[model samples]
Target: MAKDNSRDTGKNTIPKKKGRQSAVCANPLYPCAMTGAASALAGISDMGVIIHGSSGCYYYADMAVPDTLHSTFIVQDEVIFGSAERLTEIVESVSKLYNKIAVINTCVPSVMGEDIKEILADYDTICVDAPGFIGYFDEGWRLAVRELADSIPINNSNSNTNTNTDAPLTDLSKDSKGNIRVNIDGVCSMDPFHKGSLIEATRLLNLCGLKTAAVFCHDTYESITHPSPYSVSVNPDYNCADVMNRRLNAGARNSTDSLLGPDNVLRTFEELSDRLTDTEDAEIDIDISKIESECEETDEILTKEGDRYLRRHDPPRVAVYSTYAYTEFACDMIANYMDGEIVHAAARNNPPDSDLNGGENPYNIGGICSLHRIKEILSKKDFNLIIGSSFEHAAFPDSAFVGLTFPIRHRKMLYDRPVAGIQGALYLMDEISETLENGNKKSN
Candidate 1:
């Protein structure tokens, strides 16, 4: 898809990466304060957060994750310089109203040079700086976990406290087997898939008497102090894993597939179990080969559907707008299934780059800054298929749209259906099939 932005004929079109180098550069800001607040609130013994920003921020927050617990928000006046004062007032008010551990989260104010720490330093309650500008929303969740961990009083005399309080597992340099904590990453209010994942992860761990130190999500920050609680991370992401590793000495591992899948969960547990076992006879009973076989079957289904779609709608152009990890997997699988081409892809600049190397159709467009641009690109051209969150409306305002879930917040990857490995291939094929059928009707 192409849009005619006013061209600078004499200058290079694509912006250069890294070479514009000065010796130093400021790191990107966190994505949002609400993310951190969600993580911290999840971890507290009994906690709720007071978001200090516009009502829009709260609206997005409400939609971001599951409300397993109660949450309240306080909209601040942009004209007011001391919104932090309003935050203090809300904290006190919420503390009395809810009768639980309370945290006050500063929103964009965090980047505007607001002194959130100084405002809450004497409040006798937990207050964290959750600025969205510093990083992605996931990072916000992790920072909140760090703040919640800091809030815990590590009473040295209280020997009963055997939780992870010292440092992240990476900092301690402990062997993977000896370490016994697992941190779940990619937490935000928008997705609750991790909740089911935690249950499954715990169940698998219990088979070998292993325990999860904690289940970190938009909630689950209190466990940050209990380094021993986590042996490895179940859903590690760039946004939060490093903090857990370097600061808490907790083990951080991710799901086998970045996209959630139950088999991946089972395999992870089985591997951990085999590693934890000292006996020569101990072996993993969960056959990963079975999962692989299942994945192949799903792939076949996807291939069939994709081929069918292409046969009817030849040489289909497709665009994907999603998280980097999830999008790469989705695009690769779809490409293989259809034996077609992906003309464009839009995603965030999250890492480990291996996620994107689909081996077939390489992604042409990288990350998009605004959804509006996506809309413009899609509107100007024609793509037979689009896989993404509903935000594609910005790019293709009039195109028929369907939402595709990548297990970002659900407890299960396919939310009860087998969607990972080959199951995911089949599930995605079905999703696209439905979209194509519906999309064709509307387009015609």
Candidate 2:
């Protein structure tokens, strides 16, 4: 990010495009990303997200985390007429309606032109105000976590809150001596499943004595309880956690670059466990010999398949496109695992000349360069596999494509399978292997 926020362009608001799809910005601003990140941080059982936009954004979150439940949603009608009052009413209603903790997230439409600060100020005494457009999903996540952290009075003097309900999700043992306060960051959809990575993440953290304070996404409110001095980001990206760490006077670390592959996932768990548990030699103990051996066998099959058909047959150049850096990392991992080259990696909605001045985590990769340049690169690139969401596939229909569970669509549950860790590894291996095999058959 290189632009100065102080430079106020009078017409600087994101301009609306002209088309049937003109009502929305195909490239989401900071708010959407933040909302999604915050939701990811909030965890699964005790968190809920209210997208103060149209139904689409809420659906987006739902699709982003299929297993994560969004208990509440405020629609466009509320957004159009300054839904703060209704928002407050809904917040109060939600506070009483459910037993779990709740957080409200605003959308671009709610904050793009309106003084949401003023609107939220009135309700400041009552409920937290999550302005959507202040930043991207990571920023929204940071704000939500900060608000949630602030909401819970941090009493480091007390070892543990004996109140079972107040215990962090990582504190399942309910022991005061072992209450590890952990703030999770750098979470995104994995090769297999997003929530599976999260589940595995929480498990590893618990093993390392770190109590998860929050799991951001939908309906996971670990943020309020795990107010420790250290925040651990499980993924390679740590923009959201860093922002929260700064605001909360804490330290942070990003464990690994990608969290999808079994090896990467285990490494992340090991690194995070070391950081969060303050341990020296506690390596991850997942039994991966079987998976690794299987991968070797799969590699052999791929080699055989390649020789039978794809070898020297003009390997399909691929472009794995998305706005999420972690997602891009996932594609990178897949390409690396399969010995395929990523001809082009795109960040879909990154603002040009974006800056990271110790603010919310600038996690996505699109901000690396201009969209036109990315488009130009794509136009000239020769790609056969366009593996991402349908939205990404739409941009390159000429290529053979396989859609992942991105934000815009529902998890089709094609085979009732999870895709993170070893499962995710096998899924891609199967996809590419089958694709190569089919191509061979076609060629024959």
Candidate 3:
């Protein structure tokens, strides 16, 4: 976990703030709590998700989440009376199609004060009261994870035993082939790289002689509920294994290691290899050399590309705006590999005090969600390169840009591209180098 870099009294340290202030302003870049919950829950292939809110709320979430989503579509008539009938109608309809159903409450429906659990008492369903007014996307995602964890019956006697319920949940501690399984968390459907990240993480785990277990929000309901005790994350910011473990009262496992950057990927895999090797009583066996060798090759490629870029042009003075994890990774890559200067770094949401970066935030500001704030920062900072979403690109259309976060509208992504593994590191560097070189040429 990251330490408290906010307390550093260094001259270069940027002042830290608390919570998101964009709720008070307009044009907030991040999604609301309701959308976040929908994004997380909708990822389960066998779980049908219903957004219990207005049409606008339902539409926004439906568009943001790539997975299929149902909605109560409560109108003013339901609001005047109660949305119980509408919610139940949708839940009942969706129940027939899925093994499990999850309902995410939006701002209006949350304030309705109706007992959603009681309304759906006849059916086995999960209810998460994630109103948009409560907080941002991360909060809603956490709430859904907690609810999902609570629904599963923890069996201490035999971890592999099937539930007596009609839907038999599989124990994902090991696959049919007897390979050790590791859950992959932080696979929210809203993230553009979610699919690619899942594939990359699974590949890396397979390279270490392990198979993937549950993939947080992306797997089936049965698999998700019975994930392996151990887990890893592609995006640490949206990780839910810790929250799930806390809810399950399962003692902390050596999980939550992230594979966001080259250094992180190497360190995380190496640590996993050592732990698996040291467990004498366990049936696990892995070669650490494979992980080391792959990382060395990736590092060589990055070094060569980075050097090539530097030889052609001076390192870019860059500003990054994204989630805390991505911001940290981008800064580290640019500053260390490309020898660029981080003029400004801003996180769309307020990052947790501790994270995988060990609290070493290169951010000059945090909780930057407003368009006005982004424009203000861009106008003041003398950055030639911008690393963020389309919002940041629109804020300064002249600067060299790389789309690393959500809402990347300027370009089309036809392939499953990652921003989390060995390929991800190389992919990011490739974009940065090409974008910078092109921008320089256009200027000349």
Model 2 ranges with Cα > 4 A deviation: 1-44, 52-85, 99-139, 161-185, 188-192, 199-224, 227-235, 238-258, 266-314, 327-338, 349-379, 405-411, 414-420, 440-444
Candidate 2 structure quality by residue, lDDT tens digits, 303-395: 565454445555556665544444455465545545566675544333223222233322223331123334445677766666555554455
| Full ranking by TM-score | 3, 1, 2
Once fitted onto the true fold, the runs of candidate 3 whose alpha carbons sit more than 4 angstroms away are: 1-27, 161-173, 355-358, 440-444
The 10 consecutive residues of candidate 3 with the worst lDDT sum are 161-170
lDDT scores in order: 0.47, 0.45, 0.77
Model 1 C-alpha lDDT per residue in residues 58-161, reported as the tens digit of each score: 66555554553333344345435557666676667666644345453544565566666677776666555665554455456556667655656544443223
Worst 10 residues of 2 by lDDT: 5-14
Error of 3 at 145 (Å): 1.1
Estimate the overall C-alpha local distance difference test score of candidate 1: 0.47
TM-scores for every candidate against the unseen true structure: 0.65, 0.61, 0.90
For model 3, how does the per-residue alpha-carbon lDDT over 333-419 read when each residue is reduced to its tens digit? 998899999987777666676532356555544556655656765687787888888887877777788998888888898999998
Q: Counting only residues 3 or more apart in sequence or on different chains, how many pairs clash (N, Cα, C under 3 Å) in candidate 2?
A: 41
Q: Could you say which candidate leads in lDDT?
A: 3
**Model 1: how far is 429 from its true place, Å?**
2.6
